[model samples]
Target: MLAQIAEKASDPAGRKIHPREVERVFGALLASSEFWRVVALSRLPVETVAEIIKALIDVGLAVQENGALRLTPGGNARARARGIVPLIERTCPGCTGRGIDLRPYAELLDQFKELVQNRPNAILEYDQGYVTPETTVARLALLAAKGDLQDKELIILGDDDLVSIAAALSGLPRRVVVLEIDPRLTDFIQTLAGTHHLAIEVYRQDLRRRLPAELCRQFDTFLTDPPETIPALELFLTRGLAALKGPCCAGYFGLTYAESSLAEWLTIQQILAGKLKVVVTDIIHNFNEYVNWDYLLESVRKDLSFVQVSPRANWYFSSMYRIETLADYDQENRDRENLALYPGENLS
Candidate 1:
């Protein structure tokens, strides 16, 4: 029954959550063990574990004492009724998560790597970064595998990885629009589009200001790689959410656990679930690989010993999250146009 409750349960953000999102929360808990539950919820944009705990309690399947959960007599019965495996099941050998397998898109991934040398490198000031070329194509492969490609209009909030050009090269998506703060990135994208004759449009926008009026509710999907901090994630996610057209729309972005801990992930979940009314459909782990960011030390911070050199091995990793709009997009908040995400940046 879509997990419809008599009294609406709200997230920590104090905003009402969709029943559909609540249902997914329960499904995740049933599908994985406690350890995996912690891992799975980190990828989703909702305070999902709390909801699952509440559901178990409400149904008389579980109880809590001393901040720990205890399954009741009905807990086993409930698990049986739900057909939840008593223990963890073998993860799908392909996508590895509940999402579909994307290994078949090797051709696109290979094409993406071929274009890597020409792609832009990391720009430190703007926090601009690039993931490995293979991971870039992996993101697109998942998108296409999920049926998000093949003539959909997609927007990129920030494309430092330059996935937009790779997407355009696929000849699958209908439109590839971008909003980037770096003039260099925009110019490069434009140059690539001109050279390749791909229909990619690049717009120079400093997200410190409000998004363009025409961008609101204009695209089928959005993809972004925001700064790892919570505030930055909120701003990037908000802009992308506002740009999406309807409930059926989707967005893809990445978050690194190395930079953001579990608590930070929960805050992002609160924004997506409680505020934006979205549900995460897929979470592909370790999807993006970043080159070393420590090169700046060699150029500028010569004062310190160069003992810790820039890592040759690809170390930074980000999980790809595919979240879909569950209810209506937040129009009222969009109209206000005041951003609270980053104090360091100038606000509109």
Candidate 2:
């Protein structure tokens, strides 16, 4: 059955993907012939989905036809026998699944696109990738809608996406600060802030070192797109928590099922609640779409030889999380001397 194939479908690390994920991949193929659509529908990491597809092909259940997946006649019969069918598209088309419209923020999006036209390309060393211009503005719109942006002091832990600039452009936040390790990004943000006369500060600081004392307990809100590893998430979030001005403050970060598993997510949620003492208010799936990076073939794809079909579209994605501190506990917990507690902790 599908369970057997799921067991056989292992990642390069030799870990077996959950059987339910295998079924989800099968159901995704039944819904769409496009490969990237299958990835989106599966809601699994790209590498995991690719492994499932390879397993399906080995079992004669699926095949690649022109960069897309097709269910074999046997596979179709088996899926029908199991009562698995295509999922209905219930998400709002107008909002593009973000549950929020972009029409109201069209002007900001236009301005953002113009400003970032010459932004630095994603460097492999930084594990750098950015969301679309529209996504950046949409994130701002979400913050504004939630009453987190008006006259708020915001700190962005990393600026590969240049969210600091977008926040400045909105002219809503009281002040914006960026702590970026990349001199190129820090320099670019400083130049833009001066030219635009925006109330923004840019600093070049590696997050691995202790956060500057002056920056701690200074912001109303913080945002980061940390690497998906547990240690990286802990570090970024801990630093973010350290930057907040005590209770009722909020933080936003991104996590993906692509590189992380549900079990891993459960652990992360536990850390947010038990360690960081933040209550997760909202988790919007597919809320953040990353532009495909140029280093994939050299980096992510090197170990994913089973991923035969090259991506034709930008399919990488992560869910946006809004977490709020209920008490001063987070501030106390994150006030640590060493945020990097593990070996080789890299978020890029």
Candidate 3:
């Protein structure tokens, strides 16, 4: 059964389908019948999960009913015979699996919510979607827990999530600077900062270009939620690394298995340890829950007839990574070429 599914699910881009991930897909089905729930629980890309589901249905192991997946009696028996079972819900309820409680930051959450109540809606061109305001506060809580917030000069590469505002509200970071391509976000953040007297600076900068000279090696911490493309991974991480003051300075970013495969995850992990010379201190799974983007209604995927269901909930999420520099890296000497620019291919 597994081999049949694996053969059918072989990625055209050559992404290997790991047996553990297949087990996870089965485990996710055992845990939930909703299609999106399975995608979220399996911690795989929605596209990959969709292919796996199609394969499962073709193999007569699973059936789709009203956007839910159900295993046949034979399939259920086979799963149990293979010792597969539902995932135990061991995460802390209060923290929502973030392992750090948000109760302590109640005031911060309140301020963040109120401030972003009329925040700019996400735009498709930028691949932008902001996390729920509470998720923003939770991210700030994690940063504070790691001692990366208070009295630290922070730089935010992208501000659609408006993390700069939340960090400023904490009255912790020594300074907050945002380099955002979206004028709507920049204007909104600047207005809020001026009205609230927050020490935040906004610049209309694009990450595709070089970092500003003055901003290089000037920050204590950096925050960004970059796109999952490999070029994006290198550009965002390298730029963030370049902005840090020295070793011990930290950077926080989000990556999702939905858009990035485990193979891509390996590449990112290698980049962090090898080229960037950073030590990964923490990786909190499902740490950021994005508000459903409005763009999905007209997205190409939404029109695909083969997909039996569409996302009914804010199921898109990403794991947060905190990396600290192992040694002072020469930002000027960093290599930009040879990064993966496409599926299974490295750029020259």
Q: Cα deviation of 197 in candidate 1 (Å)?
A: 0.4
Per-residue lDDT tens digits for candidate 1, residues 85-192, read 433435565654435445666776776666556765676667766876666676777788777877899999888888898899889899999999888889988987
Q: Per-model C-alpha lDDT, please?
A: 0.67, 0.82, 0.82
- In terms of lDDT, model 1 sits at 0.67
Q: Please list the residue runs of candidate 1 whose C-alpha ends up more than 4 Å from where it truly belongs after superposition.
A: 1-104, 294-309, 332-348
Return whichever of 1 and 3 wins on lDDT: 3
Clashes of each: 1, 2, 1
Put down candidate 3 lDDT per residue, 107-149, tens digits, no spaces.
9888888888888899877778889888888988888899998
lDDT over C-alpha atoms for residue 106 of model 1:
71
Q: In candidate 2, which residue pairs get closer than 3 Å at backbone N, Cα or C atoms, i.e. clash? A: 45-258, 127-348
TM-score of 2: 0.91
Model 3 gets an lDDT of: 0.82
Instruction: State residue 345's C-alpha deviation in candidate 2, in Å.
Output: 7.5
Which lDDT tens digits does candidate 2 get at residues 3-92? 898887886556677877878888889988766668778887777787888888889998776566789999999889888888555777
Runs in model 3 deviating more than 4 A are 297-308, 333-348
Worst 10 residues of 3 by lDDT: 299-308
User: If scored against the real structure, what TM-score would every candidate get?
Assistant: 0.65, 0.91, 0.91
